[model samples]
Target: MTYEDIRVEHRGGVSTIVLSRPPVNAVTPRLLMEVLSALDDLEERGETRCVVLAGSGTKAFCAGADLKADNTLAAGDSFRDLGRAVVDRLEAFPKPVISAMRGWCVGGGFAIGLACDVRLASTTTRIRTGDAYLGVIPSWGMSLTRLTHFVGRNRALDLLILGEDLDAEAALQMGLVTRVIPEEDYDAELARIAERVAGGAPITFKAIKETIRAQYMYTPAAAQALETHWSDIGGASADMREGIAAFREKRQPVFRGC
Candidate 1:
């Protein structure tokens, strides 16, 4: 589908979906819709094994909702729902997904990155869940749960209630980002990481993602059971056999994503 608010680019087995609304790529209904649409397309593309989510330009990953937009306040509910959907979809995405973040990431934008399987931030990255300042909780896409899961209740509360800006280093300490790269190296590092994920066994990656997500909704025992179930599936895959053979041969295993 054609899109005005986003741009999709492909490199090898990875696809980068860029939030293209100029001037900080602020969240809007159209932008959210386009993101979901891009996910729909990528999910079905057999050649696209992984996705890298990013914002256009150097300014921001996303600046949360477009507060200054004419329809933002008028269509608050619509925007919130769309935001939730985008986050949920990203969290449950079958293939591995990475959030390549830089500049400002706030509220709904922060939620988006939290939903991704991994986040790689540039040195310039700044994150916040500043909904409290606006007299609202982060009602966009399970932000509270995701934040608490990542950083524990005390820290999540600190960030939410205080609404302090978190630099990339502080975010790394909080486990919000896997790593922070220098701005000059960020783009290449992001691509390298995306390529590595794309080269992994698809079924195993999907299973791993599903099992981890189960911990959020299921009891520990139930989650363990799910993990075992996925493990069994992975153990039976041809990729497993290929991996074993590759180990013996001391050669790289080429996974077909079965």
Candidate 2:
């Protein structure tokens, strides 16, 4: 897909979407719209088993919403509605999505990473929950719900209200990021992580993603039902046949994502 402010590179079964705006990759309406558009394309294609989201520059993953952009703050809730919608999409995406972070992942940028299934960051990465020190709370779901899921209510409260900036190691410890790698090894490490997800049985991965998401969104009974539903769907896939056959034959399975 083509976009002015974003770059998408698809290889093997993994698609990497880079936030392509300048020095800080600051959030803009156009940038968010392009991200949604790219997501639509990837979902429809179904060939993408895993998605890795990262920013283009060495400076920041995303600097936050562009207050300096024309009519950004003037649009108000309409603009925030778009941000919420894109984040909802990310939260429910069927395939695994990983956030690869470096530099400043602040404000809404931090929320974007929070929505991903996995987050891996360079050692220099700094993430803030609400940036409350600036009197800015996350308009996205992170403050109300997502942050608590990652770090529990007390820790989430501390970060959201106190506006603490979490470094890479702290983020990893808090479960905000799955791994923290040195800047030198970040690229190679993230590639391996994406490849690991892409190499899994596609049906199994989808089922697992859905089950976890359902657990978050539904009651215990409802979540169990959802899990059972996905399990059934995955159990009947052609990939399952290949997996079983490969087990019997003592070889690695090659999944076609069927």
Q: Summarize candidate 1's per-residue lDDT along 1-258 as a digit string, tens digits.
A: 789999999999999999998889998888889999999999999999999999999889988888888877678778888888998899889999999889999878899987899999999999988787898767874557777877899998888888999999999998999999999998888888899989888988888888888887667787799888888888888899998899999998898766
Q: Clashes in model 2: which pairs?
A: none
RMSD, one per candidate, in order:
1.2, 1.5
* Model 2, global lDDT: 0.84
Any runs in candidate 1 off by more than 4 Å, and if so which? none
The parts of candidate 2 lying over 4 Å away from their true place are none
Best by lDDT: 1
What is the Å distance of residue 121 in model 2 from its true position?
Answer: 1.0
Q: Please, what is the whole-model Cα lDDT of each candidate in the order they appear?
A: 0.88, 0.84
